[model samples]
Target: MKKLIVICLFLAGWHSLLAGSPRNIMLILGSADPAVLQDRMDVALRLYTKQHFDKIIVSGGCAAHGSSICEASFMKEVLLKSGVSSSMIYKEENSKTTVQNYVFSRRLKEADGTLVMKPGDTVYVVSNHWHAISVAARLRKYDNLEAKFYIEGSIDPKPTDKLDYVSIFNGEPDNDKFVLKGTWLTPQAAWQEGDSTHYLTGSLVYVTDPQNMRFSVYERRKVFSGLEPYAAGRDLRFIDAGSSWYVWNGEKLLHVEKQERKVRSILSLTDLIPGLSPAWKYSLKAGAIYGDRLLLFSDSTLLVGKRKGKIFEIEQETAASAYFRNWPYSWGRGNVSAARIDPQTRKLYLYRNQECLELNAGLKSVQAPQSLRLKWIDKSK
Candidate 1:
């Protein structure tokens, strides 16, 4: 009798496991290119026809083309046209780069505030063949060994894959056509200020190369000069704080007016954080601005602080030896100048000397670092 009872219990446990199947989630990566976007949609459509998922997440951000139309939004419009129901599709518009595509998409939530992605769920990453390895690596690192991942590669667009931009924007204003105005350049430091995204780029033989550095302002698809040849020294770095701008002037942090280019000293960072002084030892660099707090990255540490009245208070400190280990050239050697945050997403971006890293709101986990670029589209074409 005891042996029979054990067998029955084992069978019941197996039945429970089989009944609780993992949810299927298809993550369609975003692209600004009409051809690429069409291909991704095509792949998603095919996958949906074969195996319908609980949710289809389209991921991309406006930083891709620098216009109001984000990659996810554009992809969503086409997906709807392609017969994918609005109920099944979710747009993730906070991702500006490939790393962001995975990071932001996973955090997507349902109407009930429950997480769309959960442990034991199966996530299908739909992207081009080129992103297969990179996507797999990110999935392993970010998924925290909870979920299973599959990559559906759309190597190239089919001959029949045609996108109708006219139909997509039919009901909209004729002047609101999206078009690229100029060449897209990789920036040393990038940040979002108000309605515009700013890039600090130039010759970077030093941390803040004042001799050749200039600020390019991207709004929509139009690129223009935000600051034309602003004068400063080698020890200067620009930080953006939503509505205003601040600068680390080698010795003290200062608030600067964009239009007038006037500066007021805030406080000496070295005095407040002694570990960051003596440039040779620490190679201190301002990383990004989060709310009222300022984030600074050194050779081996990530120091976060907030200004309280007349003094600056240290908030948190974490060992960032691993971050610098991957970036060997150090701070001053590369273009470690411009750092910014996306106003809509609240994700902090650290434009280092080598690559760009996307940090979550809490500054805890970081998306795999990659080159940072901004998209500018002339919507008023």
Candidate 2:
């Protein structure tokens, strides 16, 4: 009987040890309100103290006045005051955006070796209640780490405002209708919907292939009310009204248009990159420039020409290959831009005005080039 009782006690102790092991906690701080942010931090610190996480990484960057201090610094200060040792708290202060917070925090591991954890190592990520989903999705991209999230309660005790609730539910903030920043490639003609005559604040409309709707309209002004339609059998052109026209191919800024559009002087890859030359010009059936290659789809064949000294020369060696004969799987009516290649994933990402799409190799896939491998390393010290 004495031996059996000892065995039962040992099992119970082992279970407790397994349950109580510390997890690596990453806390994301949002907003610039000092009082509210501090309240959230206080809640996190208390939770950390109770659960006893192995280490804490605080994330945030510069904000408005009175809230200008980097969030990580403020968090580190609070943790130190709350009795968490300096050695156990890590600060990631350079991240001005939420995604950057995760990227920079991973970078912190280099300075503090303790931040490195192997596979199966549990991690706890804390962020505002509404932003939990996006943060989780981003973290899920990393196959090596497993993470759970906690949301700090809002400082305001009142019921969440209707707009605020909607924003949180939609995975963004409630302050703006739809924030439109950065240049966009839109069709010259678009169908306008709704009775407003002017574009509604958050009106949704299809740009091209009226049958197969594309991007939605976010913002519209009196001068730019209607949607740009898809002109078939006609050349599609864009005339920049601004003093300096910046031509963006939906990914990177390609070149600046200085003169008006005319047959003699047309926008070419040579104008964007200083030393490239234009080998030939077609009547604009399907033409686009990505990196150093000028791709044109015409006469049931795809032509890829190389740029050399302000001149483009067609590559005759592989000209017979039909790689891009049926290229551009889909082009959004709102923006006809090329996808931006992610160095980490080597996959092209397309941003159609408001929406985003990931370009894959497709049904019959081909191996990716060696250059696009994941280069992330454990920087934890």
Candidate 3:
């Protein structure tokens, strides 16, 4: 009789532990299209109502060519309209890819540094049927919780849907919007030092010193006080996106090098660096000029044009290819809004929204990104 009583007590304790309250979380991956996003919301809403999910996590950032607002913001808006309480919804607004969705969502923390989704919690991922497999795979890799998938069967994935490799910048869809809103101090300061009015052409600061019969090139607005000797009839125009200075005149492009105090003309941009497509000019997002190479960043590509003594060559890689795979969550969407290389230190600085990331000379991340705010002088005040 005593043995039977002990067995009953042990079974009761096991039942209590198994029935502990584990939060049910509904994670909705985002889409760029409003119609598609609404479809996803419908699925999430149905699951939430039926299963009584404790929370919903909306994940995605502003797409490279999508609408102005981020995907998470749009999803949250739809969820609110459907009468889901704001307190039950959490937004993961920094993710732009499927891999990032799982990575960022799992790392979200509460006010007291506790994980938003604890170990025993259950996660239900709601996405299109085509995307469900990848979502499930990521959930298995990133989270140890019990996960269920709710896929909307109506929407089908297309071959043309290359969103997996899409690169995005923070803020508005238009790339030029960030520069247009502010009076940049770099170009203005470069012009002041050049003693001539200048304007930005492509990424180079073009300062025309007509009085001295020469043109000056400031690598992305790093100011040089003096001017170089000009070839009188040939008007030196914008420099190519390479370490070796290649100037474009009306007739031809010429690569020029400096020996001590004298500048020597060498070759043209096309002559040295082969396979440079004409489309590169239109796709240019940002660039930073260094002593040994020039780093050019486009929406989907990074071009490293290296120069050694007199030889020049170009190497290309997709922005989302390698570096991004290693640090998916921290790098945001694999492309930057703006880039600059410090002349003295050779450190690379990438700007995205209100954050700045510093990379060492070997192109390795130095530390966590720092908060960056562009402060303009309030002349009106």
Instruction: Give the clashing pairs for model 3.
Output: none
Predicted candidate 2 versus true structure: per-residue lDDT over 1-381, tens digit per residue: 999999999999999987555456555554456666686686686677567577777766544233555566677787788888887776654444454454445534423223343345556667555454445444444525576667767534346544223332244232121121111221222222332211111222223232332333332222222222212222332222122222322222223332331122335544544442232222122334444565543212345567686555766322212342222222201122222333344443333222334444331113311111111211211
Better of 1 and 3 by TM-score: 3
Ranked by lDDT, the better of candidates 2 and 3 is: 3
> Model 1, 1-381: lDDT tens per residue?
999999999999999987566777788877767677767777777777888677788887653554445577678887789787899888775455555565456556665434677666777777654453445444544454233334455356456633321222222223112111111333544544444444554322111222224333333212222232232433455566665566554545566665444554465655544444354222454556567776666423566678765344777766453333333222222223356776677876666423566666665335455643343322221
**What order do you get sorting by TM-score, best first?**
3, 1, 2
> Cα deviation of 151 in candidate 3 (Å)?
0.8
Number of clashes found in candidate 1: 10
Superposed model 2: Cα runs more than 4 Å off: 1-23, 64-66, 112-119, 155-381
The alpha-carbon RMSD values of the candidates against the true structure, listed in the order shown, are 17.9, 20.2, 21.1
Writing each residue's lDDT as its tens digit, candidate 3 over 1-381 gives 999999999999999987566888888988767777778888888777788878888987765234555688788898899898999888876654555566557756554345677776888888764564555544554455777778766655577854332222222234233233322322211112325534342244555553635555545324321223233443244342323344443334545432221234545445645666655534444555556665655444677778755544776555533643233344433445456545457676665434556778777777766654233322210
Model 1: which ten-residue window has the lowest total lDDT?
175-184
Candidate 2's error at 359, in angstroms? 41
Report lDDT per candidate: 0.54, 0.42, 0.56
Give the range where candidate 2 is weakest over 10 consecutive residues by summed lDDT: 369-378
